[model samples]
Target: MKPARFFTPENLQIVKRLVSRYPPGQERASLVPLLDLAQRQHGTWIPPSAMQEIGNTTNLSFEQVFAIVLAYPTSFQWRPCAPQLRICDSWMCCQKAKQRDNGIFEAAQSIASQYGVEVKTTSCLGACYGAPAFWFNDKIHTDATKETIKEIISKEFT
Candidate 1:
């Protein structure tokens, strides 16, 4: 990927705080958080230089940082268009009031048609406590019903 351009000063400040969360001798542990911040700032998969910057800042090798990005779904390396909607397909979500029956699929198709949005399925959002949750862009909608899901698009999609 090309070097991303959205690593603004404000974002750097946030990264600085996250980096400080780790002990002084364990800066390498902050790689995931730094990558997360970078993805959030750039709104897509990380640019190589951003990964490199993470490595350089944390005293980790470039390869080590690159591996972390590859492993996390939290990485946002693409523009949010026909955007990725990871509907929870895990068992907990299926048992919820807003179960992932055909309705979920139908609504996803309809929304994708209406707003040109794209839908995807992820195993779990780590929000099993809030099963039937939906991920739009980087935000989570918990206890979502079909109408609620529709409302999410109507309210957020332009």
Candidate 2:
């Protein structure tokens, strides 16, 4: 049976382009990228329907596609969450927080809670030199301050 299509026409074209990047027998290699694109298109989550479409396009079963998703929980979300703050939990970030005694993670969590923003701690945001870092609304803040976080969240939520 034909899988239910989830991607819009433009996204479907992008998906085809992504798949084409792999050789004929290696289309499955595009699964992760496809999932990322699907999540971005869906505004933060890959719904089951999108997964089904990805599986169909990649010649994988739904279970197979889901297994890949399960392996990378941080990369894929099953539900939509906006106004997100992703704190870096790398060793450097942790140490920087400790040194500053400002608790970037704790402070961000507190501020995000007040503003109804979702907060998560993910792997390195690739700003070790800056030490403390977090991503909010698609922008990464390095050497972050609690006041800055509060200000940004207030502006975004209120």
Candidate 3:
């Protein structure tokens, strides 16, 4: 991870306000918001130096800050694609994947590649019934078919 390039004075004030929200001895609670501030200020990505600064600002060690960053799905040390698409890749979705993904991918491939939209798989999205599910624009899409997935691609990139 690179050092964050934009932790300006204004961002520091925001971090102070965010940390102040937590009561004494619970400054760790402020890590998420402060990381969010770091991402926003540094250009939609968090950096190791931002983590270090966060640790220093909150009295946490570098390892402690790193653990939280790794544990949180929304926090990333690098940039994400313009539209990150995550499909369920669990055993539960195995059959559904066979039934649907080929066409969905065919329908989605051109647009996804052209727009730099990412279509990848995850272990689960938490619901077995929604096997073959995916996340688009932060919304879970379950039992998705080629048409539905295409709609998402079209709406987002076309």
Candidate 4:
């Protein structure tokens, strides 16, 4: 709640570089980078107070951070029990492998839920070549199958 007080020298350097990227009066354009740094430092979603700190650093106000928070999906607070899974359910994946695509979703949910991990579906992970892909945290799984999905969740979550 108190902005975590966990700022590291590396984070400061990153934010400083980001701020320097914009023109003199347009430092606010660094909102994306600042939010990214906040998320990386916080190890999850950006807390509201952290957003305020971002505002302080970027010469913006908390209200501005609030607006950006809603605009960016990455800034939202992670839901309860969610493993933060982002499955690709795009048309290309569905066209190439609908059965496996559907199976991957079901398998991930079922297996992950057993370990209290939440499974989420997304339209695309931008890996069309894989036909079916998913992102678990920062890791990517390509051409995922139901059995593979189960194994992945089992190994990662439990």
Q: Report the number of the highest-TM-score candidate.
A: 1
What local lDDT does model 3 show for residue 143? 78
Supply the TM-score for candidate 3. 0.61
The reply for model 2, stretches above 4 Å from the true place, is 1-3, 20-29, 40-48, 59-61, 80-82
TM-score of 4: 0.66
Candidate 3 per-residue lDDT over residues 96-133, each given as its tens digit: 76865565545556657767888777777886787667
User: Judged by lDDT, which candidate is best?
Assistant: 2
Any idea what lDDT model 1 has?
A: 0.75
Tens-digit lDDT track of model 4 for 1-158:
55454457888888889899989889899988788778778777888878877888778999988888888675355433355677877987767667544667777777777877667777778898887888885677888887777787778755
TM-score of each: 0.79, 0.71, 0.61, 0.66
lDDT (tens digit, per residue) of candidate 1 on 65-105? 88777766455445454466778878888788444453675
lDDT of 4: 0.76
Query: What is the number of backbone collisions in each predicted candidate, taken in the order shown?
Result: 7, 0, 0, 0
Global Cα RMSD, each model? 4.1, 3.3, 5.2, 4.4
Instruction: Report the lDDT of model 1 for residue 42.
Output: 68
Top-down lDDT ranking: 2, 3, 4, 1
Model 3 whole-model lDDT (C-alpha atoms)? 0.76
lDDT for model 2: 0.87
Better of 1 and 3 by lDDT: 3
